[model samples]
Target: MWHLYQFPLCPFSRKVRLALGEKGVSFEMLREHPWEARDEFFAFNPAGRTPVLHHGPKGITLIDSQAICEYFEETVDKSPLILGTAANRAEIRRLVALFDENFFADVTLPLLHERMKKRLVLRAPPDSKLLRQAMRLAHEHLDYIDWLVDNRRWLAGAQLSLADLTAAAQISVVDYLGGVDWSGHEGSHGWYRVIKSRPSFRPLLSEKMEGIAPPSQYADVNA
Candidate 1:
């Protein structure tokens, strides 16, 4: 068995969850609010972030979402999420950085801070200005995705890979806050529709948080 310490709405945590589910790796999810910075949780991850994967049999603890996902790809031979030749895999890693770093800092973090964390955990008012800026930035990222899918079957390449999982994880969190304006971006929307319908993604859609219900269409693949 494996144990995953994660926040309910963290994109990084969700990425690891999708990778684990895609590989058919069953694990116990222990919810941790990194914002709270609990002493015990800090012991698990000095960064005070969610998503620390613990392998019971090996007695190994994995920190950082990207590192954990790569470890899963290497250790779990049953299913392969990161595929293709070395060069192809490099492209996958590139897009993962695109979403995890650039897209996340510009769009996901602001919306998450305003829409989810502030209301649910911080119990503070949202910064409308920051939220608006984040929304504007999100459209740019969506357009970029639309352009990418115009040529490739998947975000990184022909096959499903960590690139798609990473992008979807962030976008899904934004969708939960009703931040994604799916209209006019048919290519991006269609890609997300397929990803959302996957069995691995079903559990994520089913999740609900108190005091901050997701929009009705948040879980709907058709939407």
Candidate 2:
């Protein structure tokens, strides 16, 4: 059996979970907060990151979301996420990196730091300035998503791929933190609703972070 170490709000972990779910791979969840810096967790991943996939019987440990997803993509014959021609697969990877790195840095990370980390780890009040900044950046990111949705059936192309999963995972975290503003981004909003309704997404919707209540619409597939 595989054990996945992750917290509810970790977008990278969420991405891995979605990929695993789509590939029909079942694993046990083991919550780990990297910020807590647990020594035992480090034994799995020296970087002390969440979403470490460990298969005890196989003695295989995977660190990094992209690495884990690719491992499954190669191993599992079901639901190929990084699919299509060389160029098509490149495009998928490009968009995945865009969301995983750029979107996370621009919108998701700010919200997590100002809202989640502060409230849970620091026990400090969130800064309105930072929150507003993150929300503003979120709108900009959403606008780009809107453009992508308008042009392509999926974020990368006509078929569902890792790009969509990666982007949605990051956006889900932002939405959970109440930093997303769906207004004026109807294209992206509609696209998100469809992803939210997928079977792979249900577990993520039902899970919650303690002491941080998500908005009512967070769990609602229609919203």
Model 2: how far residue 200 lies from native, Å: 0.3
Those runs of model 1 whose alpha carbons end farther than 4 Å from true positions after fitting are: none
TM-score of each: 0.97, 0.98
- Candidate 1 whole-model C-alpha lDDT, 0 to 1: 0.91
> What tens-digit string does per-residue lDDT give for candidate 1 at 1-223?
7889987789999999999999998999888878888999888788888789888788899999999999989989866777889999899999999999999999889988898888877789999889889989998999999999999999988999999999999999999988899777999999999999999999999998667889999988788
Q: List lDDT for all candidates, in order.
A: 0.91, 0.94
Q: Give the clash count for model 1.
A: 0
TM-score of 1: 0.97
lDDT of 1 at 28: 95
Superposed by TM-score, candidate 1 places the C-alpha of residue 210 at a distance from the truth, in angstroms, of: 1.6
- Candidate 2 backbone clash number: 0
